[model samples]
Target: MERAKPSSIKRATALRYMGASGWQPDDATTALLDRAEEKILAAATPRAAVRRLPRAVFPPPELDCGTDLTRHLQGCDAVLLMAATLGSQVDSLLRRLELTDIAMAAAADALSSVLLEQICDELEAEWRAKFAAEHLYLTGRYAPGYGDCPLELNDELCLAVDTVRGCGLAITPQHLLAPRKSTTAILGIADHPVTGTLAGCTTCHLRETCSFRKQGTTCFAK
Candidate 1:
């Protein structure tokens, strides 16, 4: 029943979600963001769970999660499969907005996107602290759809974490994650923290043309 209680989501983060390259928010955008924040606060039900998976299960059958993952998980004691969600109500709210108001719908979608990342941020912080207590450290979170990690691996992640039962999240046959704002990712655990810079946006498939990248911003920046 643990949950992520995000406090004061930054306007800049939401603006970025709306594809805003600059800091200024026009009146209309500001108003939409104001309204969207209310929806996010009401709808968010952040929840997360992490489970240990033996390294032997690294490459699930038919999964082509790229070589980046192979390097990330190298010299690990075990792999951790993580799943987190802002819950189904958030999706329901976004869907309802699509029919009622297109602008609001888009704004709501953006807000939810930022909120989900905030939730993941909280989850990672908690995990980091927990592992530190045991003299262990975690590699940066590497999710399916990152680098060589195929989106299809979502199925394996969901199954490994029992995501549906644990948090009402799932992956579709098309590889999209459900509870639309939810996420599944992996982390490598070791006695020592990762020594060098971990590959993040530099290894992303969309690095070349990502809008945020063009603005010198990366979603993966810590």
Candidate 2:
């Protein structure tokens, strides 16, 4: 009985039962879940910003690997950073006792994460167009924890973005962002034109030991 009460659940298996249960959802049920996902996204807030580096050339910061963001990110108009985490609304579904409701909640989570990534992509594209208007160039967007970028800078990026106000998401004491899958990123802008993904790869610090590089394939660097 206590297990059925819902609070004790570390995880739920709503999707797992759907195939075997032979249950059919009506329009209303589907609509309800869709609405819930919208609500979750609407409730989400994000913090983002661009910061200028100090004029004095500082010592090259140690890389999380051999990657240095400052070196790679230099000569850009600004660095775009965003931070967000799971909100209370997202937590509610996991805490529900009803099996159907729990599934809907899981649906909401899956949809929300996908939507969140979409938002980032959309915003990045829009920003690219905006910068183009002024004949500016950018290196596209890249997050802190990818390739040679240091994963540890996640905290600093969050703070720069005013994360809590912009979004309900926050990081846990251990540096894990609440909701588990939230993300942050940095975009580099160039005064002149930047090259393509293949070229970017070639110039990247990771290139020497990168899988692509290992295969003797190389990007055309500008």
Quick one: best TM-score, which candidate?
Answer: 1
Residue-level lDDT of model 1, residues 182-216, one tens digit each, is: 98878888888673235677678788888778777
Off by over 4 Å in 2: 1-65, 68-78, 84-86, 94-102, 165-168, 179-181, 195-222
Cα-based TM-score, every candidate:
0.87, 0.55
Q: Name the 10 consecutive residues with the lowest summed lDDT in model 2.
A: 1-10
lDDT of 2 at 13: 23
**lDDT per residue as tens, model 2, 168-198:** 5566676667655467766666678773232
Q: Which stretches of candidate 1 lie over 4 Å from their true place?
A: 26-28, 59-62, 195-209, 213-222
The residue-level lDDT of candidate 1 at 212 comes to: 74
For candidate 2, the clash count comes to: 6
The number of the candidate with the highest lDDT is 1
